[model samples]
Target: MVQRHGDEQSHVMEREPLLSGTAQPDSDYHACHSISEEDTGNGVLKPVPEEDEEQSIGRGETESVKDNAHVNVLKIISVMLLGIFVAQCDGSILMATHAIIASEFNALKDSSWLIISFSLAGAATQTLYGKLSDIYGRKRMVIIAYTMFMVGCAIVGVGQTMWQVVLGRIVSGAGASGMSALVSVLITDLLPLREVAQWRAYVNLVATLGRSIGGPLGGWLADVIGWRWSFLGQVPPITLAIILCSAYLPSHTSTVDEQDAAATDLLKKSKFSRIDFKGAFLFAALVLAVLLPIELGGVSIPWSHPLIFTLLGASAILFALFVAVEKRQAEPILPLDIFHSKDAILSFFILGFQTAAQLGMMFSVPLYFQVTSNPRPSATVAGAHLVPAVVGNAIGGIISGSVIKRSGRYKSLVIWAVTCSSIGYLLLMLRWHGNTNWFESLYIFPGGFGMGVASSALFISLQMVIDPAHMAPAVSFMYLMQTVWMTIGLPAANAIMQTVLRRKLGVRLLELGYDSAEVAKIISDAVSDVDFIDGATEKVRNAVVKSYIDGLWWSHAFSFSCSIIALVLAVFLKQRRLDGHKSKP
Candidate 1:
């Protein structure tokens, strides 16, 4: 039972005993289990006559409608997933064409911005999307997201300058961020917590497949037409998704009762005024201050640069200010009490560490295949190598969802999944030798499978621990956790690779008697151009390949370390049974 205490919600649950031949009560609903024996107008229970069973018959009608509603909800979920799949496709398409785009601009330095711009923009506005969606309706926000994304894509498709491309990506990323966060939130809104696992699994499977195939498709399109077509082609499907959103997506008011409409309207009017804009700005500044330096330091500038230190210091002060502001806000953008549970805190770290490991492997594994292939594989071939991992990811999500749906337990499953992922990362570390055969790519499947299961299960677990009303913001926070970890993970892994590769190549090239300036140029060129080996002499190519292989080993080692930390954290996660009630303790 749910009782409203001013603005806060309090829940009390008491399970009732079942009698023989009694109707089973819905776990989530609060309706009386059945007509009481006393209410039946007799001391002893007796079956009602077919002619006088209006109450029981009415109950049956309500249940039948509910069952049909669930089927309709599934249809809506499928449409929402179309948007997510396209978003993933857009990202992978960009990844595949990143190098080509850089060469067009004649500025390798600008390439990082293509990704960084998107990520930073996404991070900055993630909380805003959550807060705003709560104030406005979800369907309205979703339509706005699609509109913004489509506009951004059009800008990118026509972009002739580097700045224009960067601007478009930032706009696009902000919209995509909303699509990602709101899809999960909307799912929870439409379905019960227990059924979420199965539906989310289906959505996640589409996302994995879209990302996996997008790279190869992008490469093929870029080759046949041009890189610009990659952006243009995706617009059609996004348009279709927008159309679907308009026709079927429900507003928040759909869930409200007719009698409560006036109260809801009053609440809606006040929600916007109560928004913590100051908290939002401070949070965004904090993210940018820390992440920008991490992205730049040790790549374009030294790690010890005064600018990096300044940004780090500024970020600390901003964080302190953010907390102070949030504590006093009438309605904080991100509530302070959300993390009061130890499970929430621990889950964030486990997600962070696991994401770090997953991203490291995602990047380094592809590099290993590209650099070490004897004749050097095409972008298409390198993309194909990732298929096993994607397939494994899809399978894992399906299996995890099925398990969760059947048993309504997640903690043990999460622990085992993370442990399995750690072992998978270990196997990846062992299998990714410099010269690999076709079979070597299969090694990533285990790691991918574990990651897929763990990621989906972790989301379900996090949802179980938080209030249903807070689901959108909590899920958005989780997405932010992923973005933060990914931003740190990819760059950190690249830094390790660059540092290792430069040192190893320099030492080996000097031994081969190459001039210092020439060696430096070669190393720079190799890092900039993905296909630098194609232009180098046989001896130089072989040395560079060896250096790349060595660098990847160190990167994978970093991934292994992250996985170990995640494994330790996973073991401590407390398992709670899904009984459709929030525990205040």
Candidate 2:
């Protein structure tokens, strides 16, 4: 089947078919063009006999047929962009409406799982899809992902119980994870190396646009029609996107040139032997064991509980086993060779830590505004404050891409990103208090801009350094790092906010002549139901607002610390010029 694709390439090969008015395939691109059966006495090339003309015409017809069967590259990209846009939109759509969902289901205590389940499930399946895409095909995997997303959305739309919504989100997230990795791989397959930077910028822009739409739209949907419509409304567009993608997306095969036939033959024999099931299991186990415990520790159980320690110990053991399994596998899911260089290792950590910081801010900023806004906006409109930051992110990505295209360097942009992010976080940290609108609004732009620059620059830099054939797995690993760090960062910040909010709320409630248990219930209601403060007396409402503001200040401080650490790490990055040629020039 793979070799048949090579033959297909030959049959359809054309020199400037796209440039020339003709859609005909040139027979000269085939082997017969270079090695003719007969040669003219003159030093000029001669056309083949009319007998061979029939065969050449058949090849031309075959080319046209193949063209009709597969969509053009541009159409494929457009459809893929839509798919990614939908996936990203789904990720943040529920952010502003979680309180509503909790209130309706009477499951406020368990509401955190609505977000965590989605993220965790998505992260878990990313690497799995990357490997499977390599083994099977990219288009097939993407279609599968879309189908899952649609089904998950349907489940959430109809769900009556909080646990049902959590399950639906987990399913939705599992499917959405593939869109990011697969879209990235598709970009590399379709575009030239130098051009990829600009295209990536477009993708980043689309992602930001999705987030921008999601936050405000979610708030609006929750306030007017219902929170469930937020999930249901996405169904029609996503379904349309799925149909377009299925019809238009081109098939991706692993590129194996004829010159490497002998190696290809050897690889074919060992391909089945190289699945590395043990390594896959160990990797999944390690991630789940570590993240689940952290997620549940401060939220569901105490941090010092025996279960947390046990899970941590088990995670450490699983890590060692995963390493051992990789060493023994014929073709490891994660190649150890990629980490042999210090720069590659540093790139992973840089993205991990950087993502953790930004994601922390993404969650915390919205919550800060929800509690402190003067005469608070409707539940659906509360996330409008996030719009400016998202716009700044788009601007930063565009600039980063343009600069890299001109100078062919990423180090300076990386440093700019880190500095901007750190400064933004620091400013926000200082400005955050009881006010929703203030200096904090100004700082969000820089913070978002920094994140945009850093993310694009780091990925481009890593691709430049790594081997091309290994790019898919490397990209998958980048996504994994993002998911893991995000899982850790958000939960830790929430823990801090929750603990402090509980303590401060207790004191305020006690001063107002409430008992300890009554104070606990009120604090719970404050976090669980956005409508709580509206019904409370002015004195209690003021105290509740102040407590939330004070608690979130510490969360912002933690995010600031993360940015500072990322900025310090940026100083150590090794700068390199990207080589644009297919093979090193």
Candidate 3:
């Protein structure tokens, strides 16, 4: 049992030291339960004064202590949010500037690879990071992730070729995967599921801010100092985040006493072996196989290509083998047992579908403005239009979190979130034609808002249904599903857009008296480069713009359908009341 008495105080009254047991150590439980003792430097444990403790307790200062603890936790979380901000900002920056960077390298058609590389690397390593953190400790893993991110930034900043930049992104994505998963794990460590929801709202707010500003910031940097500086500039703030985390973050407490020489030696010898390397490798392979095909098909190669079919086949086989391997492991990278809960399964799909729809809109809205606007706005101006969506997202997160924290209910919020997103997509499908007013552009706001609410509510709902012991793995799995769908959603949207644009633009060009060969070349160029439309005649420009609008409408229609599916899933999601204790529905 872990006892909490006052601010920054925790005492674990365990019958036996965890390290000495034959069974695997319950690191999560130990993290929550371990005692805190001040070392005198002379190898003596400095104990708290009994009278002082009694006096503090006797004064009925329980609420005061709780308040102080809450404030302290907020401070820690605030510092941690800086890292989240940096990661989110980097993502949005790339989203906004990738076209420019790819064009610089004359690889405009390959720009989608940058985001796909990141998502692929991230999805592959997400659960591995969570499992590794449980072994090596969160602080260590987080700092390592930050260092990796910095290294990736440096590589990208200096990269002369697009493939080098892509390699850098893969590295950065791995680090980002760790950062995203570990930070949430740290928060869940600090709070119960109920409070986690409330604080996560604040996290979402910071992330939204990062994403909102990053687009404009990235575009400005790309214009002023070139795109390379955009990557280089993030290093300093990330370094500061590392330093702050080192200085202020709590140290990981071991399950064994420091004075226990044998246990310490045993732990040092066994930590690496504890990692499920086989499961991790198979899982990563499975993800790469699955996502690579999705990203490459209809972009780099034909959809009917043998390589795509082969990769898909390999992915299916790898998944089965991975499942079989994981079931026998004592400490699987992804604790598959969590899926035994109906709520966990439902939450995963709900989150996946919602995230897919939201990301599709996020990628599409900016492009829609760039392609369809009469003046042909710069990347900065196009990116600025997303501010409303980000703001709405932040607001939705705060509202959902506050409601969950107060009312201890989230089912209705989940429903409302999907509904809002669906409505947003529907609006875009109907109203965002070749020309859209500023107000009409704000149609994406509700989708962003819905995403925020889903982010907080679905997570808390997942936590409520699982055993506390499975929290870390469960959280990692949720992220895996999310990132996997993100990988699928973006490419899927792009494919749909390209397919529609090609077909519509070809038909229009043919009607305009262009020969079949001329129409094919024009369609190819238009699909490959958005700038192709800029040099066209008025008639051709209108045709290109109208074709793009048609493509966007179809994309929005797809997103709307996804949102409706998520809403249906949300309706079936089981609700459990939060009462500040771990319990199943």
Predictions: Cα RMSD each: 7.9, 9.2, 5.2
Position 241, candidate 3: lDDT: 92
TM-score of each: 0.85, 0.79, 0.86
- The residue-level lDDT of candidate 2 at 583 comes to 23
Top candidate on lDDT is: 3
Candidate 1 structure quality by residue, lDDT tens digits, 1-585: 222233343332221111111111122322211222222111121122223456556968655545655656665667778888888988998988887887798876779888888888888888777666766667677888887888788888889998898899998988898988887876765555666767778888888877877887888889999999898887888999999887766433222233444434545455567567899999989989978997888777888899999999999999999999998975577877668877777788888987888788788876888888877777566757777777877888888888887887778777777777777777766777666676766777776787778877888778766654455678889899989999888888888888899899999899889899998898889877768898889899989998888888889888888888888888778887665444442
Q: How much is 492 displaced in model 1, in angstroms?
A: 1.2
Worst 10 residues of 3 by lDDT: 14-23
Off by over 4 Å in 1: 1-66, 102-108, 254-269, 506-543
What are the per-residue Cα lDDT tens digits for candidate 3 across 397-427?
8989889878888888999999999999999
Q: At residue 501, give the lDDT of candidate 3.
A: 89
Query: Judged by lDDT relative to the true structure, which candidate is superior, 1 or 3?
Result: 3
Clashes of 1: 0
- As for candidate 1, its clashing pairs are none
